[model samples]
Target: MTLEKTPPASADPSPPSASSLAWARRRGSVARFWKEYRTHRAGLLGLAGLAFIALIALFAPLLVGGDVQSVTNAPGTALEKPSGEFPLGTDQFGRSLLGLLIWGARISLTVGLLAAALSVAIGTLVGVIAGHYGGWFATVVMRITDWFLVMPTLVLAIVLATVMSRSIWTVILAIGVTSWPTTARLVRAQTIAVESRPYIERARALGGGHGHIMTRHVLPNVMPLVLAQTTLGISSAILTEATLAFLGLGDPLIISWGGMLQDAREAGAVSSGHWWYLAPPGIAIAFVALAFTLCGRAIEAVLNPKLGVAR
Candidate 1:
């Protein structure tokens, strides 16, 4: 009997590890998501454009060096029209417009991202709390939210930015605080809808606490909405930042698209018909905003087929 020898060794090893299984599932989910996303031509184009700009922004220093922001060492004469020496022309301070545009992207994109993230984080937190614990707490939060909703967001942001020290963080803070009410309202509505589901009740019955219900159940369910909102919010944030910068509220030291516009205005570029001074930054802003909007709409459509992607 012993000579019969043991059965052949198992052809397969033990089941995949928990992490491995999870990673496999995530990989599949990503692939499926991408497959759907690819169907949106505008989204793909927008994504490509944004990616290219982001790379330029990411490598600004290496591509053009930091001295581009320095007026004292500008490579060309002030407001020189675009030519071989300076393709995008020069700003009022004689800094290369091309270099300023590139450097500007880094700061502008960063502010947009950070401001959007801050707005979303606040909104998500308020939404989850209000949704998970309804009654008096939700009532109070919604009341406050309603108050904010009724106010003019831009006016409020301007007020905050004006009162606070003029800096990048101030701009971010102003944008973040003033812009979150819409997201909070959105998330709250989604949360209320999500909690009405049967699984929420089951989770409650299973001894789940507020934290567990909110983080595990509510957040995941509402994440698609949050993500779409975040994407859209970035465009809004960028526009807002530009508005602020144009109004001379942005950080003076930061060279950004908006700042370029402000500088051009100060230099009488607009009145003088020096289109070169203003066109590049203006186009960049419009293109970047359009790209974010496209990606945002695509994501919303992908997450919820009811909202089809715009053509």
Candidate 2:
């Protein structure tokens, strides 16, 4: 007779891992973010407006001509109302309003982009170094950043522009130099968060150099924040340039939108009901500013899924 029958052993069953579940959740989150963004009305409108402005700025010369900056046509044709010859009408110098607006875009957009770029570059470097290696270096860098933060950006920019002379580069440098503090703080925070991740730890364990860890690992993760900051920075920079111009700090030779507005006010165009002189440039400025705000918000949402979902 045989012994009692033996039952077959059961294979081990395991629970789903935390890491795998997290990855799946992340994928689902991304899918939901795209879906939500696609359906967002403000996001689409903002995208379209931004595209329009960018296109116009990019192709200004082709669209109008370099004549925007030149003083041409009749000598006594200052402040002419909208007519067939001058669609947007003539300024105090009889230069084409349409041309001036288009040309102004070049200068305005240039200042905005250059300032933002400089800020981003400087901020990124400062942030990366401070965040990757903490302690005294972080304290020193952050203290400087705090000093800048305490100083009002617009007023400081104005002072610099006035003191250094009213040139495009002067304004750009002033805005750029002072602008990076906020960006630096933002980037530093993002860098600090990213540096704590497991992949970063792995790189550290493998004896990865600081440069490698920062460039290859940290930067990629923090880049989205930098990019979002850039969009908002463009809007801020443009406004700064306009304020400088309105205060007569811009290049006298350059007929920017703000300059046009200033001249219009001085010429009493508003009192004379010559709305044409002020309306176009004002609308253009508002349009561009609104576009930037919208696009920036949209980009921020897209880059930060949690923020997007919250909204």
Candidate 3:
């Protein structure tokens, strides 16, 4: 007796269109990144708070309509409680604390962004070349990185600032130059991994030049790591700048958070019980640094899924 055989399930005859498949993959990546970021509630809150502070900093002149460095007529207004006249109260010199905080935000964020940009650009170049070449070039670059790694960054920065006359650009350039070694090492390691991939071999077989391979292939793949590092680097740069300023090695003309802390220290604000003088700027520095750190960690979890899995 012959039994009737069940027919096997037929697969779909048509495959997904190229455009449709590409769009789907793009959407998936974005959604995954979003989900990973949303998993960090503290990071999100820090980002929001930083955004608010940034807005205030960006619009300080519009918000308070006076020179950030200009002395006000409120000399007798020291330690006034937060009121309509002075929200966040006044410092020892009777300058508006709110104004100072906002202006300081501008300086901190500017230095942070500029230094990060410079470091990332230089580091990416150095890393890509060293990793791609992978011989004496790599050895030399890595040794240079180790050299900087051994030096105490703060002491080096202080020495540089002292020699350079403590200009704002000097501080920014110093931070950016000094900080690139770590980022270079990270990028080189990432590039080494990516350069060994089959696609890189295919590109090489197709006669793609080092410039093309580095720019179009290697750089894009290592960018997430570079970006995460940049965020963290910005925080370090700001802190270093502030520390330099506190040591009287920062730009004297700029009313950065470090400058405020310097003024407070000189006036003995710490012992005077006028917490208003030092507290706001100190909090601003701490909060801004915290924001960058949180954001960096969130991005790291997204980019390095191994870290997430380990957690």
- Using lDDT as the yardstick, the better of models 1 and 3 is 1
* Tens digits of lDDT, candidate 1, 121-238: 9998998888778899999998998898899888999999899999999999999998888889889989999999999999999999988988888998899999999999999999
The weakest ten consecutive residues by lDDT in model 3 span 72-81
lDDT of 2 by residue, 214-246 (tens): 998999888889988898898888888888888
lDDT of 1 at 304: 93
Candidate 1 root-mean-square deviation in Å: 1.8
How do the predictions measure up, each by TM-score? 0.95, 0.83, 0.86
- Better model by lDDT: candidate 1 vs candidate 2: 1
Model 3, runs deviating above 4 Å: 1-28, 72-84, 309-311
- Model 3 CA RMSD to the hidden true structure, in angstroms: 6.9
* Winner of 2 and 3 under TM-score: 3
Report, for every candidate in turn, its global Cα lDDT versus the true structure. Answer: 0.91, 0.84, 0.84
Best by lDDT: 1
